[model samples]
Target: MNKKAIWAIIGLMSAAVIGVVVLQMDLIRTAVKVNEERFEKNVFAALNTVVRRLEAEENREVFQHSINGFVTAYYEEHDNTGEGKPEFTLDYSGEDGRPMLSPKLSHSSLLDELMAEFANPCTCSQCMARKDNTYRSLMVYFQQNTREFPLEQRIKLQHINGVLKQELGNRGIDTDFNYGVFSREKKSFIIVDGHYVVEDAQPKEILPGYRNIYNSRYKVDLFPEDMPSPGLLMIHFPARTSFVWRSLWLNFLGSIFFTTIILFSFAYTIHVIFRQKKLSEMKTDFIN
Candidate 1:
């Protein structure tokens, strides 16, 4: 009913507005962070699914090369770095003493060739043009790890040799594959004996994005538990903007929600002040 009361209400409303604005920012940050985290976690999970599948499968050479081609192209298109990349590796020594298969290989003469092959043969007919040339003397090494509970060493070694031998044999050329299991005690790598031949019937592609249509089956359930395991490709998750955005978004959303409440409170205060003023005027008329 008094001027002081009206001014007090106005001040409170003003403070409410300011509070709402400040809190809104925090809400928005919170919401965005939470959403982004969920997104990133989902993406990481999808990637992990691929990793697990590759690891679980006995043979991974073809799949590794195919995925490498796809991922390399995908990252290049987005201008993203292959930081904390998964351990899917391609090491190949060409005739020129250069590692031709891995994109990370220094002195990559086959970059153009690889890109062309992957884009053309791997891509659809209407996709893009690609060159075709099977480079000779290219040695590729493919490795993946399998970890099952109730640890068995022999079985692990058998898996390592079997996958490698089968893959190499399917490619139609025989090569000696050196398998050394890493050790902390011996400080030496042991040799795995086997001559592998890639057959003509079940041909394996050494190039990226090439497919292998093999139907031969090998018995893998009889290996001993003391066999040495092969090295695995590492998958790392680096600090990314996705992580930061996820954190910020959660805070932002929280701020926004609080801000909205503050605004509503301010509006209600303003309405009450006007109603009180109208009542005061009516009381004055009655007195008059």
Candidate 2:
């Protein structure tokens, strides 16, 4: 190929790469920001309902049942089984004058109580560990098929970043927490993605008070009688999307694609520049 043509190709390739990178970065950032806001609002809304119900009932037993039910329902509905069954079955007296099961919380009294208790803080360590009500609320919210705020309606990127930074700082931790939010584009979806490890300076100790509350709240023996201390709280912060491939592999592939495009473009540009200089010298020789 002629020197000019080679140079042109190199220039075009470089421009193309720069364009793709700039565009992708912006799109992903926007997507991540939009998703984060959607998560905050939607998750909070679900949690608010639970809080209101909890406070209204003030019955520790019933409140525990509702909260646990919501959590169970969330996991069950999102289960790998692919069964589209309702998680919480409402038990009540039917027209047949017998008890029946349905996927409805017909007991408004129970729901009302749950909502109320949810409104008030449980005054426990884990709950008090974080200051924000929204995050705390998310720790225990449950509802299904509600209209979520549009991506635009979500919080701004700066705001989200600020809140997270502040929350982490308050906990005496330093780490970049990358969050993304997306919806299944279908009715009632559950997604799990994005994970990072948090290192604890102190030995993993589930404070007695916190463990007791979690035990009562979830009805699960999270702390076994056998082990003294679990030694770590694995914070599995979820993403709005499911990963089709492992994250490490995905990242590796992306890096390779980006690097190849840049390196090839640079090498091609250098080759074209030298070729052009050579051609110009030959033209000079011919003219002399």
What lDDT score goes with residue 72 in model 2? 71
* Clashing pairs counted in every model: 48, 24
Local error of candidate 2 at residue 255 (angstroms):
6.6
lDDT of each: 0.43, 0.41
Cα deviation in Å at residue 69, candidate 1?
28
Score every model by TM-score.
0.29, 0.30
lDDT of 2 by residue, 1-288 (tens): 566776687678778777877776665556656655654454444333333332233334434565566557755765757755443443324443222334554343444533454466678754343324433333333111111232222223454344444544554333332332221222110111122222233425533423332222111111121122111111122232332122234554675688677878777777768877788889989999
Candidate 2 structure, TM-score to reference = 0.30
Candidate 1's error at 50, in angstroms? 1.0
Cα RMSD to the true fold for all candidates: 21.5, 20.8
Error of 1 at 38 (Å): 3.5
Model 1 residue 154 distance off true place after TM-score fit, in angstroms: 26
| Tens digit per residue, CA lDDT, model 1, 166-241 | 5434432232323323222222222223222222333333222111101111112111112443322112223334
